[model samples]
Target: MRPILSALLLVVAAGAVAQPVAPGQRLDGIAAVVGEQVVLYSEVDALVQQTTQGREAPPDLWSRALDRLVDQRIVIARARQDTTLNVTDDIVSQRVDQQVAQLAAQVGGEPQLVQAYGRSIDEIKVSVREDVRDELLLQQYQGRRMREVKVTPGEVRDWFDRIPESERPEVPELVRVAHIVKIPASDEAGEARVRAFAETLRDSILAEQATIEDLANRYSDDPGNTNRDGTQNGGLYTTLRLTDLEPRFQAAAAAAEPGDISPVFETPFGYHVLRVNSRDGNRISFNHILLQVEVGEDEAEAARETLSVLRDSIQAGTPFEAIARRHSEEPQSAARGGYVSVPQTRQRDLSAEGLGPQWRATIDTLEVGEISEPAPVTLADAEGTQAFHIVLLQKRTPAHPLSVTDDYALLSQYALQEKQNEVLQEWVDDLRETVYVDIRAEQYQPPAGG
Candidate 1:
């Protein structure tokens, strides 16, 4: 989330709430004021915490965050002065719901989410609503103030031409290729065997023969836990993507309630079982045991041979799309005829980067219709080494300089963004002049007297 959006939303939601000072409660002191709105130490602290929740921030982050909050409040206060800029409840509500949905998706599910945030779903919804309302108000104000802002084609061309050849945006060499994935399923006997193992483990835990943590260290499929205590410290299980777990594991995890231990479940990987430790909003903290399926060397060799034959058949005239639809285990891309759209340019170097180097090297050298030999590539999936690919290049675009005919959309976006920045800077300046702003003396003190 952007700092501007986060700060503005916080103000919208929590700003209007009555601040009743209790005798015992400590106050952090006021940082700044915009009209009736006051930026307090507590508010700034909250903003900083939210902004830096999952990431590292610099030492001056709090000061920068405070400045941004002050600016946002100023913008909102100025906008509210114009009665025409009043935001609607419907628009605010819709934006709030969208943001909430996105957050919910990130955490896992609603019940799990409540546990994580220590707040009910309704409370979260209300907070989101308030934040979104302020955001919409700010947007509306921006629109009204910058309605006439425009950039001409000549300006865009000039901007493009100003850049030297070395500085010009380089188009990435992209590959358009499709794939078919086949994941072999574990047999029913295999599943039953894994289930019995889970039940035995569960009995041992119940009987004091072993602890859940000890079992997790020995049996958990999660690499994060397999070597140490099976437990992922501090409810980290929610962060795991559903696609990263075996289908059966995902099903069990999704169905299990906080404190509930699930029976053994079978997946392509083998058999497993899990226990949900806690639920926070959409995120669930859980622990599991993994019984990996054992494949004979011959079986592994046969699977590779099968992929080789499929690759040959495609090269010999079998339609790639038909082959993928019939045999591909990857449900997501198989339906699209195995076409994975590559980005125009990658940031990493091709020669020494991990997957980055391989991708960059392969796409750069291969022409259309050429199929790379069946490479023993790692699966870019949770099922891990079970699936591999023999990539057939479908289309390739060479690197080139930007042009109006070929990159009008990109250039237009750049032009619009430049115009928007100008409008925003002007708005900020105008607000600074109109609003009553006072900076603390300590904020601008010189390092030392000359």
Candidate 2:
């Protein structure tokens, strides 16, 4: 049975739900019937396009799409009957605004977004509001389902005891790890060069050596306002508070008197030089340029050396968890004493898989309670942020059957999951019986009683 609590609804697009038919294009039709609601072929097509991106369609993709739509319709229909799932327009508007902001960031600016989508921001909102409403309804229903689920200790132990020893599954070998992470400091020389660049831009604007429009167009990485004629409106930020600007940029702008160029300042995005054009109370209008810098390797070796010293302290009997909580930069595992969870998580099933191949090889040789020397690993993000980690392998466990003695805690969790899944399945089966689901497509139809 499919998971009933999953939130996998399609994110609606900026245009009409159905795509406009091109010349010689085939007309779309209804794909399924879910009670009073008709599932459109176009709706399924949009979702399939979103998930698959530009890739070739997977086998039974249509069936999977139909199944999701049916599940959503079932949940939504039931939700409308319940008075507890009330969601106001304001709440959905906030969600819409956040989604739009994300899209703006993704595309760089509002003007570029409008050009790309061929729709104004208001038009995009009207298209997405229906989707947001249905999603919020389903969220409330899932919350109610979770609140009604209860598990007891006796239920956990009884479930574990009934599983035959020979038939129990073997878990993969696993390691628990804690880590301290640090990024190298930005290069001082490069930073100075950037500051100088910002100052030059600021000086040019101040002396009227170059117009704000010219300097902003030539130098600023900040997205400039665009006109229909495709000309930028330049570095001017109208009606913004000093606080609205980034801290480093704000401080510089606040210090400078109106009509003077502020001292160049640095921010994560780049170096900035602000010229306050006017001030009214706390709000100000200003123009600025951003000069991006690159800094990943600077001071990296120093950070590694610091972590190595920390590991030595742990080796000398300092409690790993306490040290991690106090000093470790990897927040998730440090709070739990540096333990990285293994996949074999049931009672007696403590295991980890696919640590970097090199890390795994070394971890295989270490026993429980032993610590592996800091192995160097580089992590880079989508924004080109690069950092190094000094990892501590805190604990190791072998694959084994359910153990009443060592794995009681894990067994309790395992039992709880099993109980929840079983309860949720029964709920879904009941929902299916109440719904008027008709799968018109042959391959997409559900089996009887399924």
Candidate 3:
């Protein structure tokens, strides 16, 4: 779940209450005041309820939630004053649409979602749009603040030294690896077969022989068109932006009107026959039937052969990075000269346990600086699509005590985070001093365990 969607859910859930109070009467009291904004007691209660979720609430929960709300208001006030910060309507609209779609899916559909939330879809969107903007503003402000923080090598060493020798954490066995990936080529015959199937589905829908939903349930290969429990989603996608889609798919949809069927089109994923359910400018709601060509054993073998030749060339003095850049099919690894970093982290080093069984077995016997023979594996970020790759084990460090000299990259990340937190605390303190703040709620105090 995205933060925005989660937030929307919480807000929607909290606001669904019905009260007998007069329209002009305030149902909730103010918990705090930060600058021009007030944090309501209801808001604090909502957050505490979410955090506790029926678990016994701690004594300080309300105070902590109030503190968080006040801090957010302070930051939001600062963001509003900054001329440089902008969260455009388009961005807000797209995010709100995504949240709606996700929430709608969970609650059965848009109508069900509207009924559950006690608001029309448009009203629901209007309610959460500003919240989305605020969240985005907070993200932008925090990003800018964190960017200003930096750590020196001396700081990293000092951070490591501060940890007493007896308390030093043991380093796990880590492997830094690289690979040249080759997606199996789609044979001409297979492509023709898949395209023909897509055309047939398009024709069937056009002739009223079948509904798009029925065909999608039976044949659509797109994983996004399915729910987790093996139920089909009828291939529905809501408020899809043109730029977010595959180029050919986007082009096909762009040329079509609402209720018009797109001609069978090919994207990197498969051949698609799409129906534009509706369109509002560059954003469209659509249903699609996708048919993918399967790779035969011969095609898989050919990919392996290509990697085998590249492996030989690399072993015979050609640079692995150069060859990987030219021929590796996986975009992220290829862009980094085939070095596969741990996802969402800047560090290339990965613990052995983090590597999936397939990869661990592939590199189990490989020595440092040696390249393995081409082996079958699933490509990353490719939806478990089978591909072949040749691995290069760059460096492998056995489990040992943490040391500044051997683990500078790891130590540097922790040090940088520590410095960033210090900077953020000082900056927030400065903001609180300048900003007008009043607390009507009880202040949070740590429990005696501290």
Candidate numbers sorted by lDDT from highest down: 3, 2, 1
lDDT of 1: 0.60
What alpha-carbon RMSD in Å does predicted model 3 have with respect to the real structure?
11.0
- Candidate 2 clashing pairs? 174-351, 174-352, 177-338, 177-340, 178-338, 344-349
The window of 10 residues in a row where model 2 has the poorest summed lDDT is 1-10
lDDT of 1 by residue, 52-99 (tens): 554666777667656766777888778768787767787777776777
Write model 3 residue lDDT over 371-423, tens digit each, in one string.
Answer: 99998887666247789999999999999899988899899988987787677
Kindly provide the TM-score of model 1 when superposed on the true structure, using C-alpha atoms. 0.51
Give Cα-based local distance difference scores for all models: 0.60, 0.63, 0.76
Q: On residues 1-450, what C-alpha lDDT tens digit does candidate 2 reach at each position?
A: 001122422211211144333233345667778777677665565456555655777766656766666666776677766787778889989987887777666555676456545579888778777677766777787657856776687887788778887776665665666566656677888878878877778777778888766777777777554545877767777756443354445556656788777677665577777778887644578877667776645477776677778779888988877777877665555666655554234222234555555556656666666665555544422333445555565556676665756566777776766776677656766888998888776643322111
Best candidate, TM-score:
3
Candidate 1 vs candidate 2: the TM-score winner is 2
Model with the higher lDDT, candidate 2 or 3: 3
| Order of quality (TM-score) | 3, 2, 1
TM-score of each: 0.51, 0.54, 0.56
Q: Report model 3's TM-score to 2 decimal places.
A: 0.56
Model 3 scores what on Cα lDDT? 0.76
